[model samples]
Target: MVNPVRKDGTLDPALSIKNRFIDISPPKVVGLSNGVKAIEWKDGKVIMLDQSRLPLEVKYIECTDYHIIAEGIKKLWIRGAPAIGIAAAMGIALGAQDITAKNYREFIKGIETIFDVMLSTRPTAVNIKWAVERIKRLLKERRGESVNRLKELLIEEAKKIHEEDIEVNKAIGRWGSQFIKDGDTVLTHCNAGCLATGGYGTATAPIFVAIEQGKKIQVIADETRPV
Candidate 1:
């Protein structure tokens, strides 16, 4: 569960869902008792679970440099629309922390460059573009602020994005569960579960919630073939 919002409206880094929800007791899935968090920040670096090795080995890759995050996204190390968006936002935050510019102008230019690289990683997910643009807008709004303050704000914004995603997923689950009747069978394709999104999932969230609500819903997932 996400912590209550702070008085300042910005999410508390200590209370952020990424810290409270992702690694700590994760939702259970058959065969994989341990839960997986696609992206997270720890020890002053961005840590991402290597999705390419799923169901075989759970490997985590630590990224201190933002460029590596771009490569990770392009190579599908982290997938799903919402997850991609969160990764992009966090990548921008990480990139901002590494800027050694002497002035705000140079810092803004450096951030813009990082934005472009992150946005170019995946074309199919509009969420990625949306998340990057959100940070870009924040940069524009705080242009007059000091570089260090702006970096802190960007990190906070990324955490906000992450926390909001978890809430959104839960709300999706709650609302969608209403439409599912007891004993209903659901058919799905590809991976849409806690592993795909911040938590819960877009398509599978309802199923999980329905079961929790005592609805005997059956789910069948298709084995998606790559094109």
Candidate 2:
């Protein structure tokens, strides 16, 4: 879930939780479920689960303003590599929707400003840079388009990024699941579970797939200590 971090870089306990469940369910490509969606677009806003409150309270933060989205990413409200990218894309779209420029040049400048803000949110996640660049490229290609149309296109692109990430996760799960035998045990490190990706996850997807395929494989996750 996405819980806003305080000025001191700590999550506000009022907006976070203490205990959370370990969900290893296979990623759902369609429809909604109990599994946390790292990021989502709904009714002209970006909605994210308050991951800071996971395993206990399921809270969500909605962002109609791109600045809020940027803060969310900076504060680790919505994390995971792919998920961060998705959030950046959506944040760009949200920012685009509010552009009041009367000409293409002004609109492009506004978009660039938004891009710089999002890019500065985090320095480590390459996916965020990749997603932002994709959005920038798309915007450049549609430079002559009207601001309204460009906004629509940006929103669509953001949603596309979110959808493609889930598909990629599923593909990873499918390919990785093949290595598992009926009773093979799996081990994972860190938080590479569903909470750490757009869906499924890089490291935990196979285990979920195996369980879904009726395999009795077991999973042990190492909680990378010393936080």
Measured against the true structure, the TM-scores of the candidates, in listed sequence, are: 0.81, 0.82
Count clashing residue pairs per candidate. Answer: 0, 10
lDDT per residue (tens digit) for residues 73-136 in model 2: 8887777888889999999999888889998898988888998999999977898899988988
lDDT of candidate 2?
0.79
Error of 1 at 58 (Å): 1.1
Model 2 alpha-carbon miss at residue 138, Å: 0.6
Q: In candidate 2, what residue range of length 10 has the lowest lDDT sum? A: 23-32
Clashing pairs in 2: 1-49, 1-50, 1-51, 2-49, 2-50, 2-51, 17-53, 19-55, 20-55, 21-55
- The lDDT of each candidate is 0.79, 0.79
Q: Where does candidate 2 stray beyond 4 Å?
A: 1-33, 224-227
Question: What would the TM-score be for candidate 1 when compared with the true structure?
Answer: 0.81
